[model samples]
Target: MREIQYEEFEEKIIEIRRTSKVTKGGKNLSFRVVAIVGNKNGKVGLGIGKAREVPEAIRKAIADAKKNVIEVPIINGTIPHEVIGRQDASKVLLRPAAPGTGIIAGGTVRAVVELAGIQNILTKALGSTNPLNLAMATINGLKELLDPRKVAKLRDITVEEVYKGVRREGNA
Candidate 1:
């Protein structure tokens, strides 16, 4: 058996609908479901499944999401830098914020970011707010994050010193 690492909760189905197509003999019906899965611990996944039954489709979507889990790096409870991502029609702009800023986001992007363990950040959703697209865009933004420590090492400077300079400049 495969072990499940994420504690799944808040399972939601969006755009649940049924459609029918007329064939030569009869009409064939199909169902579509969009599923969102998350651990509420800085890890989130999304999957879409289509089937004849709603329950089976949801189960399949959850399984697929689990298999496709992606790890998002967190720094000081926020992202390291600004990032722009697109998923279909959804375009998201994510920016890291200083401590105590809290999360500034809306719609599905908010849920994904919160679950991804981001505490202080800013986000803007452009183009569309379709749940799946927004979620995917948030994931894309998370994937582009780079830890401040890593950036500090790359620039050969201490993280604290970098912030100290910013503080000094802000107070001036």
Candidate 2:
């Protein structure tokens, strides 16, 4: 794991929703913010925080996300294979891409992938389009990645052996 500091990570607010509570005193208004924090080095997290104020909610969200940070397997600035993640009704599909393909994702998926330092990849959202669900699903997909070296060790083979015939010139 690389050294991570809160100051070093970039932050983005994915979505914000407001709620009003009915009380004897009148109505209590609160903001719920879906926030993402990433070091752009394969470490990223997603958080949801609710507060009476937006900035406070964002701050809390960032702190909460830091506690839930996860490291993704990044090879050549992309993932090792195609993966899918589901959270509630949301499903996110992620696939590795060539170096120059850039990030091919929408709002929620884009934010999550960008923070994970994934520069070349493709993504598709299925089922739910809700930002919170999508973000969680994206994180879940990243959580499932296994490094090639680790897989090779587990299989009692070398990395090249594990990937034999998988790489070809202009195959990206």
Candidate 3:
């Protein structure tokens, strides 16, 4: 059996709802959990799970999140560029911000960014604010991030040249 690491115990439970289904005998109650998982280092995941008990539901959600973790590229403490992501009816707009901007995101996006160890970012929720959808959208946005190093390699330029251009522009 695969052992569960102690670190996996850490997770943010975004939302929990008790859902019931009517049956011939009466009603069956179930719990739904939405969770965000991250290593606080530009890797994050979101998961949703349903179970008869709240703890079990959360556990399942966390496991799913770990299995789905995505690596988000970070540059100068922020994303390399702006990105838009959508999941179902939820849309999220993510923009890279200068350092010290301090994560100007709301709700689920904020939690995701913080856990992903992003120090500066701007985000807007364009559609449904449902926690689950928002979380998933944020993850999708992060998945699309491209690092400056990768961009520099693609453009056949040194990373230092990229920063030098910005510095020159600031001084001018």
Model 1 lDDT on a 0 to 1 scale: 0.75
lDDT of 3 by residue, 1-172 (tens): 8764535424788999999999999999999998888887877778888999999999999888887777888877888889998899999999989888898988789989988889999999998999888988888888887777887788667788765654444455
- What does the lDDT read for residue 163 in candidate 1? 53
Top TM-score prediction, candidate number: 2
- Which parts of model 1 are misplaced by more than 4 Å? 1-15, 98-100, 152-157, 160-172
Report lDDT (CA) for all predictions: 0.75, 0.92, 0.85
What TM-score against the true fold does each predicted structure earn?
0.75, 0.90, 0.85
Give me the candidate number with maximum lDDT. Answer: 2
Per-residue alpha-carbon lDDT of model 1 for 85-120, expressed as tens digits? 889999999988899999999857776777667889
How far is 152's C-alpha from truth in model 2 (Å)? 0.7
Pairs that clash in candidate 2:
none
Residue lDDT tens for model 2, 1-172 = 8775664889999999998999999999999999999999989999989999999999999888987899899999999989998999999999999999999999999999999999999999999999999999999999999999999899666788666835445645
TM-score of candidate 1 to 2 decimals: 0.75
